[model samples]
Structure formats: structure tokens, C-alpha cells
Target: MQELQNVVSTAFANIVASGAIEKAVEEKLQKTITDAIDSELRSYSDFGKIIGERIKQSLQINFDTLGLPGYNELILKIVSQQLEANMSSALTEHIQERMAELLAPAPSAIELSALVTEFIKLETERAGHTPTSDEFTLIVKRDTSIRSMRFEYVYLDPDAYKSEYQCKYQIRIVDGVVSNVTFNEVDPSKKLFIGRLYGFERRLFQLYAAGTELILDDETKEISTYYPHCD
Candidate 1:
């Protein structure tokens, strides 16, 4: 009887082990779960991409409709060019009006300019030559025009010297064109003065040619700077 019981128990164990009643294996179940999770995670990734694209579209539409500040540099440059092109004539007129307003000196300033002009002319005539910097004691003490803008005018008479300032310049401008520039500073010794006069005349002619607008370069930059105009 003991042997039969052992035999039956052994047979039952063998059958169970041989997969007559199979159950899910741990490794296979784990693998299935992992695959499902991976699929779900991939879908989530796609969903995130969709959300990002939607956000981008929404922002672009808002920017266009509300005129918000996207492409700010490009927009500003294009608009400036358009404005300048379309309103060239009107812009010139507008600029001229503004310049007139801004450049309109006070009554006192105008009076001072007139007096200085008269004084210089009278002094030159009285002295029979342009006055030296030291001789215009009152003007020298009061204003720096003589020192600052001396290059704009003929050379000063130094210690009653006449020949040094004798060279004369004749410049004619019509319709903003330098039709003629005549000067007697032909001697090699006076070439430096001629060069200076050339620069001055170039500026004067360019200012007239530009007419309410300016072309920026090394030569014309000072026109934009704040300089004390003796005139």
C-alpha cells in the first residue's frame, strides 16, 4: 500500500510539471506588461508633440492679428524704408518745417549774430585788414567763434601782415551745384590752406545739395553734430 501511494503521488507531480495544466510564466507576463507600457509612452510622446505644434500656431496667429512684436527688427526696417519711399516729398517738406522751427534763433541770438557780423566787417575795414585774434579783445574774451571757426574765413592778419591773407576765393553755387571755385592759393607753400578751403567748400556744397536730408559719411557727420554756428 505504501508503494502504491508513492507511485500515484509521483505520477501526479510528473503530469503537473509536464504542463498538463499550464499557468502564465513570470517572464512572459512581465514582457507583455512592458510592451504595453512602452506603446502607451510612445502615444504620450506623440501627444506632447501635437500640443507643442498647437501652441506654436496659436502664438503665430496672435502675433499676426494683434500686431505683436515678432520679427521686430525686420518689420521696423521694412516700414522705415516704405515710409521714406512713399513720402519722399512730404518728408522733405516736413523736415524743412521742423528745421525752420528748431533753427529759429531767439531774438537776442539773432541780434548778437548781426552785431558780430557787423563788428567783424567794421573792424576789418577800420584796420585795413582782417583783425587778429588778439586784437579782437572783447570778442575773444566773450566768444570762441574766432578761435573755433577761424578755418571758415580768410586767414587773420598777423601783426599787420597783409600778404599772408591776400589769397582770395571765389566760389559759385547754383541749384546746389558747385559751378566754380576760384582761389589764388596755388603756391606750394600755401597748399595746406587750399586743402582746408577745399574741405570747407565741399561741406558747404554738400549741405546745399542734400537739402533737408543728409548722407552720412566722414565728411558730413559734423553737420549732424551740435556745433556752435558763428553765423
Candidate 2:
């Protein structure tokens, strides 16, 4: 009987050492946790709805403590107002500047003398001539009866070493402005007198001979002649 009891005790010790019971318990606990999670997931939409309702109720209860509009709405409103204010200020400034320009007086006749002087300089330069201050003379004549002005200038070509080549300009001005400046005649033989000019300068003179208008900018002091479909 004692041997039988010892044999039974040894069998129990072996079963415990094999860890079957502990493994079964662990498996059961894991299965229980998985099933619980699956069930909760199946009802997750409903759970979220309920939680969202509770949170909305809490916010409503504390509405007075917080602001009327939410933080996002308030920030958006502030940003919108600032943008509108900036745009309005810019528009106002632009309108004022335009109005001032519209109300400004026309440039005076004296201011136009500079235009004549520039014309003479550009023409002389185009003719391959640089005249000293003493070698050139400008005569401006205003005819109020015809509402026109005439500019006459004579210059001695500095490039001519063999003989003094005297160049002359007669510019007509109407309405206190001049748009087109051209030679009295387009003599291909004049190239011989002026020597070879740059290709661009030759083209410019050709266009002037062809009756293209010369565009002048008073602000930038730029002179350009118009050529169709050309820069």
C-alpha cells in the first residue's frame, strides 16, 4: 500500500513538471481575451457614437466657460478679417495713386527742351558723329500760330579727319510732343559719308527712312523705333 501511494505521488509530480495544466490555463486566458476584443470590435461603431454624444453633452454643459465659437472658427475669422483689411488697404493705395496721376498737370514746354536735346544727341550719334560742345549749336523755334515747334541743330562730325563733315537736323514738334524723327532724305550714298555703322544702327536708320514711328520714354530716356514683328 505504501508503494502504491508513492507511485501515485510520483505520477502527480511528473504531470506538474510537464506543464500541461499551466499551458491549458494560458491558452484559455488568451482565447477569452481574443473573444472579448472581437465582440467589442463588432459593436465599436455604436460605442464610438455613445462616447461622442457624452463628450458633446460635457462641452454643452461647459459652453459658457468656453467661447461661443470654437477655437478653429475664431482663428479662421481673425485670419479672414486680417486678409480683407490688408487687401482693402492695398486697393485704396492703388486707387489713390491712380487718381493722383490722373489729376497731375501736363509736363511744361520747358520740360520738353530736354527731349529736343536728346533727339539731337541721338541723331548725331547715329550719324557716326560726336560733336564737342563748341562744335554744335541748337536753335529751337516755337510757332504758336501753327501750334508747332521746330528744332534745328548743326554739328561737325568728329570722325571726319580729311574734311569737316557738317551734319544738320530739322525736327518738327506738334502738340508739345514729337513721336517720329527722320532724315530729310534717305540717301544710300550717305553710308559712304558716315562710314560703316553697326548692323542695328543701320537697321534703325532704314526703319526711320521707311517712316516707322520713333517711340521715346521721358522717364527712362530710351529711344526706340517701331519695326513690325521685330524687337
Candidate 3:
């Protein structure tokens, strides 16, 4: 269980360093999130019945209505792509609007931050353990105009023992492709970037040409975070 917690923490950190994500596990998380958001959107739209019918009708017949690969499956696979390659305030507003449809109005930044922090804390508590000091300072950036994400988490004990992770993701909507992704770090240096990029090339195309964008979510949560942004 401790290993799983570490893996989860490391996984998020890897996403921060390399703007890329996998299609499998990401979907599971998104499903829960989407369900909540969808309820909110439905309430706001006031056309919940109609919209629900549309969702069922659209998806029940035409496979394309489901969205890429397999609709739900594709959403899991491509959500990170959207985060890395096509992020923007407009996207955030749109999502917020969707949330408003079924849930209460969007939470303020402070409220959102508190919610996120509590959620993470709850996860740690559920595991019957505590996140290390550095794990408390997680950072996440999402940009909609270009769609991508970058995030990091670090743990440095008072004795100077340290563990860190970073991940970055880039998505290309034009071709429905992931252009680049890299994660994991020990002693970071310039040379490390090359190896990270090389590993990404195995799965993506022309990743070297892209410049990553990291847009902080003002609503992010924190606990004992070292960075002002995380705090």
C-alpha cells in the first residue's frame, strides 16, 4: 500500500516534468471526475433530460458519437493531450460552465484549492500513512489554448534526503496525436533532458519542436508546501 501511494505520487510528479499521459489509468480517474462535472452541467443546462437523451441516443447508435477510439476510452487516453496541447482560459470557463449546469456555481479559487488539498489529504489518510514533506508541495499546470500539462512533486527530509519527480505532456489536436511526454527525475541536469526527450520519441512525433506551457490552476491545494504557488 505504501508502494502504491509512492507510485501515485511519483506518477503525478512525472506528469509535471513531461507533458504526456497514458490512456488506461487516466480514464478511470477522469470517469469519476466527469460524472461529478456532468451532474453539475446538467443542473445548469436545465435541459438535463434532453441532454441525457442526447448522450444516450448519440452514443447508442453512432460509434463516432462516442468520441475517438471508444468515446469514454478515448477521453481517458486523450484528456491529457487536451491539457497539454490546447489549454486556455476559455477552456476553463467552458468546463466551469459545464460544471455549473448540474452542480452549484463554480467554487472560488480559495474554495477549489481547499477542496483539492483535502482530497489529496483524504487519499493519504485512507492509505493509513502520510505524504512526505515534499509531496505536500505538488504543482499542476493546465493550458487549454494549446492543450497540455506540467506538474511536479518533491520530498526533501530535514536530514537532506530527497526524492523528486516531474512530468510534462504535449498534445496535437490536428492529428489527434500525443507529440511528447517525459517524467521521472533523480539528480536533474541538462543532460537528463536529452535522455528524457529520447525516451519520449519512442512514442511521439516531432516532440523536440514544441515548447511546453504550464498554466497554474489558481485553485490548487497544498499542505506544508515549500513553493508559494503550491501553498
Clashing residue pairs, candidate 1?
Answer: none
Best by the TM-score measure: 2
Separately for all candidates shown, the number of backbone clashes (residues 3 or more apart, or on different chains) is: 0, 0, 45
* Model 1 ranges with Cα > 4 A deviation: 1-12, 15-24, 44-162, 168-231
- Order of the predicted models by lDDT, top scorer first: 2, 1, 3
**CA lDDT, candidate 3, residue 18:** 78
- Model 2 has an lDDT value of 0.47
Please, what is the TM-score per model?
0.19, 0.23, 0.19
Residue 28 CA displacement from its true place in model 1, Å:
3.0
Candidate 3 CA-lDDT value: 0.42
The digit string of per-residue lDDT tens for model 1 on 102-157 reads 33442211122332344345444443554333333111112235553311222222
Query: All predictions: root-mean-square deviation over Cα?
Result: 18.5, 21.6, 45.9
lDDT of 3 by residue, 1-231 (tens): 999999999999999667556655688789989987787677356577777777878777666774547578778778877876677777788777644432333222223234334435444444344444433434343334543543332122211123333222222222222223333332222342333222222222232233222223444443344422335
In order, what lDDT does every prediction score? Answer: 0.42, 0.47, 0.42
Give the worst 10-residue stretch by lDDT in candidate 1.
Answer: 220-229
Q: In angstroms, what RMSD does candidate 3 have relative to the true structure?
A: 45.9
Reference-based lDDT, residue 62, model 3: 69
